[model samples]
Target: MKKVLIPKRKLPWGSDHEAIIWLMAVLLVVGMVNVFSSTFITAENENSAPYAYLLKHLISMGIGFVLFAMSWRVDYHKWRDWLGPVALSIAALLLFVLAAGTVVNGAKRWIYLGAFSFQPAEFAKICSVMIAAYILSYRVEHKLPINILNAQYAFIAFLFVAVEMEPDMGTACVILGIPIVMLWMAGLKTYKLQRLALVGLAAVVGMCIYQPYRLERIKVMFNPWSDAQGMGYQTVQSVTAIGSGGFWGMGLGQGLAKYAYLPEAHTDFAFAVFCQENGFVLVALVLLLYGAFAYYAVRIARDAYDVYGQLLAGGIMLLVVGQAVVNISMVAGCFPVVGVPLPFISYGGTSLMMTMFSVGVLINIGRYSRAKQAKEKLDELRRNNLKNHEAALAAMPGRRRLQRIK
Candidate 1:
């Protein structure tokens, strides 16, 4: 098959249409400071340079920018052609990591490559969105009968199964939920979607009961004092860090929790460190930035030129927003200890790159939407001018005939 060349248009970088970019930039800068505060102390105590932790995160940010810029240059619609293969590659990577991954804190989620490690689950979240967007776009185009046993739904279920078996339940849920959102946005009826939701709620309940660890985490959430120094330690530390903030934080780099008190200060529980170091005010600012990002993403999805672009942007919006909620909930003690990281803010290279890439796609959708609107306005004006010109030409014929007769 011949490849189609998607013409690239120059986008106005300073336009308000790109508000998410500004929000993301602020979040990224704040995350760098928080990661440094959380990780540098530990690195320094171990005779490593204080900037070692900061350097790694900065490097991830640099790489993420490259991915973002590259993604923006391409038309997101092209992915529809081979989203299946892309998704299969991500799923295969998930399985591969499960079999030959680096074991850290009893979970084999990381694939190490020389000096750095990457989490396949992180990229899988974005891939799930891409796959779902493709399938939903196809269904909407063909007006397929999408019942409970639909093949597209089954295929999406398979992706969820692979992710869940990896034991990364949080990411698995995000991956599954994003597609549901995309399907809804693609014009699925509410009653049909409600049935899916009911089933999802049942599955959540069943999983909590079946998985002892998940149930234990729930118990720990309700009564942090019960386990104290056991399974509940992370929760207790996180709560204490939040409570200690008290309107204003202990100040950056001065958080007591990072001094060997809180575990996973740079990864799963990074938000707790953020709260401890930056206080409620800065935390509020971060939340505001997140809200802005969500708002613009939804706008992009709403304004996209076609169903495919809309679904793609909408699916990605769900992934980022859903992950942020899960990560923040884990930190705020509202949910069980799910090891999900804040998007663009966490100290993981894979997560950062995937998120930035998704943002870049949304930017492309916004650009296309704007361009299409401009073209429509121009066409409308041209049509109006042609009609007026035709009226003038008709009147001129009558005048000429009258003058000739006279």
Candidate 2:
């Protein structure tokens, strides 16, 4: 049998956290630049300044960076205890949004705060992960039997209902998807898992039947050409934008489809805009970056110091990276057009900030794991030295005899 060789590359700043940051950095830079190129046209016509959208994105990025720094250094353990209150707070916000949220594109998802707006569901993703990690790890740690339908899952169900009511079907999927993945990773029993899957399937069917818009998306996905001007408009335009990019792209800020031709040039279909401006060459590079992020995120989760940390990091990775996969798939027409946003690349205030904070939490767990490994090595060495000293003392003279005599 041959052993596998996994190379360890040191991160900058001499940290043994085994953290990966460069890919995220690339995504942010590319996201900001592409977002600017994709929206400068609309911004120019909507406002006098062509850079207005870019300036707003920069402000959002600045806020996200601040959150990232704080979460990256904080201990991951604290979130375990604070999961309940945090989740409740998010649920309250969700309800408030339903009650008095600012509607956009016929959906009441964003809650306005004076001049700016933010999405509570964005933060709810993290809260959902935290609750799962906390409950699962707590059960294992305390030797409690797994109750599949405990208050923990009930809260998540409530959140799902709230988000779905917001008519943000895409975000609703993510809300439940995070928990299902976490629960599976946390080792749910096969029978219980099957039962949950059935329930989830039933829910999906109900949602699709209830929302004619969702059904329309499915129809458009299979053949956008049928209604290219109706429900298929966004999908047809999205694919068209990607196809127009060709091999080398039209160059930055040179894309014409974004000029009132394709909807959401900087949001759900931002990847399409990215391709339209940078072509397949940068697309390949961007995909590689996204892959690297997923790989390192899983590695960080695997290297966590404890069960709680492992579940925590794993859940965060699922939420962040999983959302990216969903969004990209929707844009490529591989999946139904759901409004899930790319993690760091999507032009938004809350999603980017929440994603950066997730990465920060992952990095913090990695740092803790490194320190734990060092401590374990030191303890092993001390034990070995003690054992050797005892052996030598015993062989030196009548150590056993002395003990017997005493």
Candidate 3:
């Protein structure tokens, strides 16, 4: 008798996963090119090699990719077990930064180790998301109440206050916003969310008033031209760069903004340099890539295998895309200059590595979800085939006699 053959089931690739990888790759390339273009003049003026910033950026990218791979290989569910230690470590680091971090432009937000610096607040953002995911998922599974006085809220507040003391209100705002958004998505009561919103608003308002510089930023945001050469200088320059790009741009490496015309052109205002050099057409393309990223990120979260995965992906999506929105708006004069860097495009080692790590976790969740769905599909196919075979046997002559003989 001839042997019957069955086909092996193959795991399916998720479109969302593929799209995310491509989008990230494109953004990274854009970031590399822009960083080099925007910093060579400044590097030369500072008595450094023209490619100094570019080389450092390349090193950071290399390290970031390695971290991305490691994160992608780890099981996201295991993060629940590691949350406690990670949160404690982050808390310690934040305290250390406040005590002895490197000061730049009046903010103590970095810890210098030799030639490299680390930002605890970036990791703080990651910890905030993980804490919310673990606690919210546990509450949901145990059928417990979603109280506002849980460890989730405590950790978020701790991170917020620590980062705020770094005087990085931009990062502190982001840390606070991440968990509140996650809470709402996890089905917290509307009244509770509203209350949280009001408190957050009050905190932000008080913080602004406490710092005279922050209030000055708000005033300059509304009328950058009023103080064109003072507090509003950066904003005015950024808007001018963006507006001068017009439809076709000034061409690569040909922009005047980097000639001592715009401060921090390669860091916080990198997007402004990009807009000035690449024109409105490429700007639109960059925006579209960000839009596509958000779309696919939402799809991944929606199709996640469990609640924790859903919330994890959702929080990360909000972090990356929300930060991008705020950075772009700040550059375009739609929002105050808050020192928020554009993800993947800004030239900061700590920010780049942490962003890539978070994205890797998201991709791993997508991969697991895709595999689960494919396995379910394959099992259903096998069951249906078995049912059809049994029905055929029942309809055949002497089916009972054949079954008894077997």
Candidate 4:
């Protein structure tokens, strides 16, 4: 057998998990290029600086990265202890937004804070995950029934309803998706998981059944080009830009769709801008990057040192990848457009910052994963040595003689 060495471990802003760190870096760069392309036309039309959106996105990314570093350095265990108050705080913020949110494009999802406005729904998604994971991990550990109607799951349901009331059905789905995925992966039995799924399905259906905007979106998903310039206009434009990419894309920054043709080019439909500029080949590459990131993120979750890390990291993996899938599908017209931003690639400051913060949490969990195997081995060695020493003492002639005398 080979000897093992345990070195002092440190988290220095960058993760020990290089795959996640580099993948995020590449995606942020891609976001900058595509965000500029997507927003330049909108800025120019508004008579703002052509790079204004790009600059704002940069500042947002900067702030997000700082919080990312902070989260990475902090211990993941603190979240478990803080879960309840954090959940209540997030709930308060959500209510505050609902009560005071500024409307944009007919959606009441953001609150104005002086010169800046933000969507609390974005941060609420992460908060929901932390809360759900904390509760579910405990349930799994204690062999409690992971029931859907339970208050733990009800908190998630409450969040979903709050976001849906904001009419941001896209984000509402994600807030729900992350927890459901986490619950299933945390080893909730099939029958109970099924119940949770059914309840979730009912909630989703009920939320959508009465909304006119949602109904219109569903109709557009099937034949987006039918309306050409009305209800289907966004889908039509997105598909047009993607189809125009041909074999090698229109070349970076050369796409025509972002010239005020695609309304949400820098946000929900960012992938379309990327497809328009980078072509099918590079578009596939971007998807592959997301794929690889998801794979490694899951690897981190599987190898984590504890249940909390597993649930926390796994839910985040679902949150980022799930949101990406929704945005891509929406752009491709396979699903109706809702306001889900491509993780790490969208133009929204709050969205980008919160996402980075979550990624930081994932990275923190991964750091323990990297050192876990070696640490476990060392622990096993110490246990075996201690047991052997105790046995030898018990068997010693003097110890036996003393026990007999007593």
Candidate 5:
């Protein structure tokens, strides 16, 4: 008998994974450069070292990279079992933030831990996706109906209210938007979805009216120049910086807007500063990177190994890309300023860490999907080879004659 050897298969590393990794690296590098360029003047004005904010951003990036590595190495399925404790811990933190969180810029959204401040709402957003993905995937797996009255909705609602109470409407809206998008993707009935949409709309309107400033922001979104020095000040400055970049930009770190002219130049409006310093060409390139990210993320989601992975990847996609869209629109004066930070470009430690963690999980899912596909291919190949070997044996000598005689 002759020995048969099956070809060794390498773990598949598709373009989707490569694209995501490259996109993240490029965006992080751009973010680091823009963070320094945008914040140096502000740091000097505060009597701090010109590199102060850049150093802090670097520290956050280091922590985020650690998280990303851990998430990529761990099995994403473990998160399904840990959801209960994770949700409880996040809920408690949200409550604690409401009670005694550090106040910054009139928003009590952070809790100080040693030298670092933590934002519970950021965790809540990712947790909400996990919760929704787990619940919906479980129900579908068990052949159970996905009712609106499930614990997933309850927990998400609680998170939304807590974040809103923190007076951080931008994050609250993001928290709310995550599950709704997931629910739709989960194949909820159209009627239920419509009802949910109506309720969401009503709640948004009520929340806006509850805060007079929110209404003002909405009005200013439509006509920012109506009162340029009042509610529209940030919008006007953001637009000016973006437009001033012209075709080639004013050159990095040379933009005049970041010299205390535009508030939150390093945080919420980091894109504006980047546009001002890098010009339309670089802005277009950056936006193309984001667009490519979204495209590859969608590919990963659609090709996930199972229903759970699909939903999980889809939720993460919405979380990152959706937030980027909202932030860019707000900065462009096309939407109300909701203070949402651009994903990798924003200078928030917790946000950058959580986002990196989510991307890590996504990458893990992609790896699993590829592995499963490779295993399937190997199994099919083995089966086909075995069939061929059996046919050859039967065709040789008296194998078929022996069977006929029997």
Candidate 6:
């Protein structure tokens, strides 16, 4: 006799997950507006069309949407197999960038193609999370803290250091930190984890001291007025732009700071332009949306039926929230301007694509959670129905022993 082949099962996205995707879409729309606002004055100075930069960003956004849709359709679990190869490919690209990448403002962080550029560090981040999740899923006892020097963890650290050599500090930090958090959440050893963290900190400190620009950025952050016209100009202008908006804002497309005074107004400092035009109210709303997203991501982890799914959800959550903190901190002058872009709001093709891919993974995790819950609900219903049936049988005369069957 021939046996029948059964199809593999997959999960469906939950309501909250779908809501977050919509929120991301809304934020992208708002981001486009700010990108356009930041470009107008600069384009005028260069004799370019009024919307040249905005048009380019809009085009990128269109591409991002297509990638986002594709990601949503594919199964994230397949990445477990693809993670290693894709990561190796990305690692090679980063190495290539370090050796021959284009330099923009002293950092060789992009692989350029005539009119387009791609940041490998961006994609490397998501890949790191997926790889970390795959490695940590083997832990049998889910505890707290984790050893950082294990072969898998060390690989993650090495990958991050390679990205950092591209000298993308913000991406490097996130790439390294997110995996550590995921591993810790999956269970390891706390005292051992602390030791590795201290060593990592010392290494980072040494690297910072060796790099003049990185050191200079740190100094300027501590004292923005120290070099008001040089290293400090960006932060100072950012503060002014955010401050001028007050509580309500100067109104959309009416911001004075975008008149060429605030550098990177549409990219790294896009939040400032957003705050300038939309005020604290809208900024708070953006924060709320992010908070909601973070909340749902955690929920996905908590509800995941298996260890891999849990770690994957947690790692993705950490990546998004961690990046948000770094971006906002730079704009707020709490940290040095490390060139991290606001997710869904920054104007870059590679950044947008990677972010959407992470969202796709999170959506996949949500699907698993939904499937697990549905299965549990079905099992519970079956148990209840079985009990009811037995109880009804027990009610029949001479059926007193039916309760034992349950």
TM-scores for candidates 1 onward, in order? 0.91, 0.92, 0.93, 0.88, 0.94, 0.88
For all candidates, the clash counts are 0, 0, 0, 1, 0, 1
Q: Given candidate 2, what's the lDDT at residue 100?
A: 94
Whose lDDT is higher: candidate 2's or candidate 3's?
A: 3
Those runs of model 1 whose alpha carbons end farther than 4 Å from true positions after fitting are 1-16, 397-406
Q: What are the Cα lDDT values of the candidates? A: 0.82, 0.85, 0.91, 0.85, 0.90, 0.82
Give stretches of model 4 more than 4 Å off: 1-16, 381-406
Candidate 4 lDDT tens digits, 15-132:
4357788889989998998889888888988999999999999999999999999988788889778778888877888888788878888878888889787788887798888887
Question: Which residue runs of candidate 3 sit more than 4 Å off their true CA positions?
Answer: 1-14, 394-400, 403-406
lDDT of 5 by residue, 1-406 (tens): 9999987756333468767988999999999999999988899989999999999999999999999999888888998989899999999999999899999999899999898788989999899999889888888888887666886788898999999998999998888788888888888889988898998889878987899889999998999999899999999999999999999999999998888889999999999999999999999998998898899998999999888999999999999999999999988999998879999998889999999999999999988898899999999999999999999877777967788779
Q: Which stretches of candidate 5 lie over 4 Å from their true place?
A: 1-14, 399-406
237-264: candidate 6 lDDT, tens digit per residue? 9988899898999999899887778878
| Candidate 2, 26-55: lDDT as tens digits | 789999998888888888888658888889
Cα misplacement distance, residue 164 of candidate 1 (Å): 2.2
RMSD of each: 6.9, 4.6, 4.0, 5.1, 4.3, 7.5
lDDT of 1 at 316: 79
In model 3, residue pairs whose N, Cα or C atoms come closer than 3 Å (at least 3 residues apart or on different chains), thus clashing, are none
Number of the candidate with higher lDDT, 1 or 2:
2
Pairs in clash, predicted candidate 5: none
lDDT of 2: 0.85
Please give the TM-score that candidate 6 achieves against the real structure. 0.88
